[model samples]
Target: MAEHNTSEERADDMQTQQAIAVEGLTKIYGTGESRVAALAGVSFAIDAGEWVAIVGPSGSGKSTLLNLLGLLDRPTAGRYALAGRDVAGLRGAELARTRGELIGFVFQSFNLLPRETARTNVELPLVYAGVPGAERRRRALEALDRVGLADRAGHRPPQLSGGQQQRVAIARALVGRPTMLLADEPTGNLDSATGADILDLFAELNAGGVTLVVVTHDSTVAARAGRVIEIRDGRSYERDTVRATPAQVAAPRQLQGVLS
Candidate 1:
């Protein structure tokens, strides 16, 4: 009984410190013979302010776990808590609201509106939250400035370089002031040089206390994170938990050629 109480207390403490926590998370598609388990009994906890990378080859369940972490999908059976709130059962408007309020996502494709300016793109989440227009613009500009894109706020997606468009996407993600940033293959669309720059930006943001969780198959990207969660065969394990130093982040292997 004492041990049980202690375990429960520890879990409560973890909930206080963790940005994300999942236990026995499972996802399945179809039924009976056609059933495929994308994730099977995966569990992990990420503390607030930690930078983590989720890595796996194609069909390794990394993307499936990311989708769950981002609240884009629900698990078939498991417990998930986001910032201490039990989110496993939320649906419809409540789920959407929880997702928008607690998490921000950056995608490989730099999903920005081609017709909107950078400032407008960044202001989108605020618009969804029904923030006043003046405040939305102000917050959007602030977020753009954080990503070092303030000068290009008036530029549309087509006018920006691939790297710049991604930076704008990052700014949009940050504008929501989410508990954590969830990035799926954030550097996949950029050249090595530009990707290195974006990685540096991620390092900078992590240094400034923004919690980040990046999903990628790139070993170089994973090495830059403080922890690496490697998913395989529908399960995940901590592959490494060595916090990367600034020097290490600055000179990742992909940047070697550029630096040389």
Candidate 2:
């Protein structure tokens, strides 16, 4: 009994520090005859520094869950606690501020500004957050360095290769040192080799204690994460049955070998 009570106490403490928590989360579109439920009573918690992957086929609630987690959309009926603060009801400027302060986003499309230098692109978030110019520049350069794009910081998006541009996007996402990194199909556009490299970068970031939540349809990508949450028909389930191919499991080992 004592051990069970201790375990329960530990779980409560862990939840208190959770980077993202959702309970009974639901999103519905339209109404009556045209109603569509994107997410139906989803519940989960992602702890700080853990690597999680959300995987599903087309029409699943993967994107819908990502939107809610990123604070881009509100749930119809649920509780969402980001970094221990309930934010399910926050809207407008409050929502934007919370998102900017606690969450960093990386999209499959390298959404870099076409005419801006990589450094300038990375500085945009800091600019919005009201960081001073000199400080923003310093942080942007540091973020670029973290993603191994410091040498290309002066180059515009069109001048960089696809992989390089994605790295710049990642740098931009990390510039503010957000509490959680939310990536949606991050490697969807890259070639196999380049995607592998990006996955390695993600592993490195996770190793350094970044809380990462990746939304992808690729089983290989999901295999690399520490935990996999499979969403189907607007509901989430923790995947315990192995869905990874032998090659998929071996890929991360190969990456680890290279890193070593």
Candidate 3:
């Protein structure tokens, strides 16, 4: 009986693990008449290396879920775990450390420091993580090179074009080598061509085993993900998974030369 119980416990523990997992997650604001439920109850699990997209119209609670997933805000109820560790109630330095260590962020605005060079901006996360100066610079440059922005290392945000600035932001996000990458409307500010290039880059990264969670209203962006989750009225519903054609299956290798 004792051995059987131990085996059952192990099996249950194994089932809860993933890159991201949430059960009955809810976030509420205000009280009574003014109360609003940003997320009523969302439960989902994203496996490691899976590319998932969250899509919804405005005010659908997608943004609220993103904030919760990124650990910028706590849920009012239920559970959230990243890499199988519960994080629904993390706060203060613990929260900051977990977020910094496990997640990378890319934004639509290309949030870079106007006065700082590309390499400097890319090194910011490592600095906050207490990496030494010499190692930080090397890692930052490597990340920029991965995104095809190595030659622009000395350029400031204002000095670069929009696509270039966004690349720099991607490099910055990659510098820390976080367990997951969270992007919010990453292509919102770019032209169609440029945005397509970025999307291809994201696909390549996902192919290379990076876990991605993107929140967007753009159908094109949502289509790029392997799985889509729709948020409506603070609830979540899983859409059909995107099946890849033969050519699409072979496309990741070809994506390497896209930015080049």
Candidate 4:
């Protein structure tokens, strides 16, 4: 992958390194009179290494879109491709493997196993991916180091501070080195100061060429991303890109590629 690209170069070549592409994406629940169109023919594309936020009020289909993007649910009628592969038809072991290897997710709630050490929690994805124990340990430690949490690897979630717990969650996400990172309200539980630091980490990761797609209602959170997509009534609308940190700019808090 290109280490850096001018905005023009990036835009011009987005199609070549597409991370996600959806066309006429729709999701329906129930049937007949009870049927609801949770997502209505929404369509969009996100390029590799780009950071995009999905924002909308509650019940506006933001969650629906996020679920589809994260591969937690399938669209009822549409084409969805992730990491340059068509994922709309994958099922059983194939679908499970693709989801495990192609995406890393961070939820608003730090979902670490309270009884497990940070290292073990970070190793979970690798386990599901069928990695060898020794390799998983190496990668898990490497991932914790990336998130600045290597020192806390022996601590369980309950023993860490809230911010530390979140860091551990981030480490877990990075352990797989997936094609994209999907965050849902990643900073929702932290104070503004701590949240900013987390955002900075995300910026560094993006600078290091990780693609990020965040779901948040906070404008400040959305502003941190290079682009934003708003969902309403099951439809999607793209907003012009804005920034807390420019998508391709060197990370302000750290040297570029620090997380690579």
Identify the candidate with maximal TM-score: 2
Task: Rank all candidate structures by their lDDT, best first, as comma-separated numbers.
Answer: 1, 2, 3, 4
The residue pairs in collision within model 4 are: none
lDDT of 2 by residue, 87-160 (tens): 75688888889889888898767778999999999999999899999999999999998777889999999999
- Give the TM-score of each candidate: 0.79, 0.81, 0.79, 0.79
lDDT of 3 by residue, 174-230 (tens): 889887999877777677887888788889888878899998878999999999988
Model 1 alpha-carbon drift over 4 Å, by segment: 1-13, 31-34, 240-260
Q: Write the per-residue lDDT of candidate 4 for residues 122-219, one digit (tens) a residue.
A: 99999998899999999999988876787988999999988788878888888888878998778877778878878988898899898999988788
What's the lDDT for all of these models? 0.81, 0.81, 0.80, 0.80
Task: Count backbone clashes in candidate 2.
Answer: 0
On TM-score, the stronger of 2 and 3 is 2
Candidate 1 lDDT score at position 95: 88
Range of the 10 consecutive residues with the lowest summed lDDT in candidate 1: 245-254
**Model 1: which residue pairs collide?**
none
Question: Candidate 4 has what TM-score?
Answer: 0.79
What does the lDDT read for residue 55 in candidate 4? Answer: 84
Cα displacement (angstroms), candidate 2, residue 57, comes to 0.4
Runs with alpha carbons beyond 4 Å of true place in candidate 4: 1-14, 31-34, 158-162, 240-260
